[model samples]
Target: MATLYQLHSSMDKLRRSTEQMAQTWRAGDSIILLGATAAFIDWLNAYLEDNDIDRIASIYALADDVAQLGDHTNAKLNLNTKLTAVLSDTEWVTLTQDPQFDKVVTIAL
Candidate 1:
């Protein structure tokens, strides 16, 4: 079990790493690597929350763009799922309730 101090230190390190990755992303660096860095920051934030650490704000501040990229990717995936005929009717109905799917369908029709 990590002590509070250790948890804080880990979060700080993750925050710093995320900041450096964000700078690299801004300079037209490898997006795939930047996306992975953002995911790492998100995982760190979830870990901090699980351990009762107050570091959500810092994590978000350091990786907001990466988080946005994740959100966009998810939205696109959801849209593709809805358009594809892979899901059953029940699944399709459930997906229709999703905002991303609903938006895509509304625009298509």
Candidate 2:
């Protein structure tokens, strides 16, 4: 299980490389890289969801990225939506009980 710092560092590197590639107007390559980035983000999202970290560091990172990208409103909305979902007791319990997610929450917390 990766720490929050490790996940953040990985995301930052990916974003920087993706941005650099996009600046060259290489549409196909940029698209491919962006797709890979999105996949990585989705993996993080699922990991957070399963570990009950959706309301913790993951949302903070996501919101920060959204704000840095000049999408404040969408970022706020996304954070609110994910937090709301995570607040449901049943959902929270289910997530916390998942064996695959146990280590991340323990390490992250």
Candidate 3:
């Protein structure tokens, strides 16, 4: 089964301490959600830019969440250009129900 981890406004934690991220995610199978923090895109972009081995499989972010970022243009461009699968908030429930993802883990930063 696929493992799903929710970073509740704690993306910075993953940047500083990658143990949890590494434990739950495996490279391209991972999804990026624009949490409450604006730094999420920066951190994610930096990581993706610096590391070629770990490619983002998909991204799930509400339109409002993406708008909160100061540089939504670049962020949106990055996500759209890099990922083929982009899900909205409503689709999260459907994804969770998928047989592929049976385990949903919520991690707070």
Find the candidate with the highest lDDT and give its number: 3
Count of backbone collisions within predicted model 3: 0
Clashing pairs in 3: none
lDDT by residue (tens digit), candidate 1, 63-107: 333345467764653423322223344543454454432121110
Candidate 3 lDDT trough over 10 residues, lowest sum: 47-56
Worst 10 contiguous positions by lDDT, candidate 1: 100-109
Candidate 2 residue-wise lDDT, 1-109, digit = tens: 2222212325545544333322332111101111113224554555434433322323222323444444554454454443322223453345445453323221111
Q: How close is candidate 3 to the true structure, as a TM-score?
A: 0.61
Q: Which sections of candidate 1 miss by over 4 Å?
A: 1-35, 60-109
Q: Judged by TM-score, which candidate is best?
A: 3
Q: Any runs in candidate 2 off by more than 4 Å, and if so which?
A: 1-7, 11-41, 48-59, 62-64, 72-77, 83-109
lDDT per residue, candidate 3, 1-109, as tens digits? 5565554456646564334555556654545464563345557556545544254455566556656655756465575555344466777667767676657666566
Worst 10 residues of 2 by lDDT: 27-36
The models' CA-based lDDT, in order, is 0.32, 0.33, 0.55
lDDT at position 97, candidate 3: 70
